[model samples]
Target: MNAYDLVRGLHILAVIAWMAGMLFLPRLYAYDAEQNAKPEPLKSEMQALLRTWQTRLLRIILNPAMILALIFGVWLFWLRSGQGADWSFAHQPWMITKLIGVVLLFGWHGFLAGQRKKIAAGTSKYSGRFWRMTNEIPFVLAIIMVLSVTTEWTLR
Candidate 1:
């Protein structure tokens, strides 16, 4: 009911939403990639997959989740220090690791979109090798996030 509790709740909720999206989306990509590899014709299936994931879910769900995650995170950080200029944040090893993970996640999302776009137009061949290979990206990013969250180890 208090300000700290409210922000803390929002922060936890946002992290759950964001982590769910990040963790599951990669698996979805794996499913989509396999489904795409089956003899269904690459162009049409690729187009459909790209539109649904890259355009629809990525834009509507993932994008907003990232923003909400960031907002709630900033709110939590502010609550911790009571100031936007809090240098103590830099001293927090977990926050630093999380920040790096977030950066990788952001780049991975954009990279997914770019790959989808490239293969969507039929200009580039829809290669299963390419899809399967790059699909490891989100997983790696997610692991960094997991370690960031659950580890007591410190870099600072």
Candidate 2:
């Protein structure tokens, strides 16, 4: 309807896209790690295919989606501020919480990228179990963020 509404929609869409890759990539890593125990050409073939998928997911989906989400999210925040929404941490603890969650998500994205590089380089020390456990990070963060926004959770 309005510009704020449009930006908010874009932000949500981008976040969904980002989350898809965030959730799926770790599973791919888990499979790749597990493949190390398999024999010969099968292991090599699976790793190569997984690596390709990882690279494309990161480059084509994750990176652009994250950047767009950040941009649109900031736009929404600016629009809200223009409409006199309180953004200060003291006045809007939920906003601060959401922002912190976003930062953590970004950090997780970076960590995954680093892990992908290590995996490609044949130097990753992480196990399939580790990757599987860590795959829940984004989902947990999303719950906190969504609740913060929907509840307007605050100290006051």
Write down the RMSD of all candidates, one decimal each.
Answer: 3.8, 1.7
TM-scores across all candidates?
0.67, 0.94
Q: Which residue pairs collide in model 1, if any?
A: none
Per-residue C-alpha lDDT of model 2 across residues 63-145, encoded as one tens digit per residue? 99999999998888888877556656435889888989999999999999999999999999999999999999999999999
- Residue 104 in candidate 1, Cα distance off native in Å: 1.3
Off by over 4 Å in 2: 83-91
TM-score of 1: 0.67
lDDT of 1: 0.65
lDDT of 2: 0.93
lDDT of 1 by residue, 63-154 (tens): 78778878887777787777666667556787788778778877876766575565445444545455566656666776776787667366
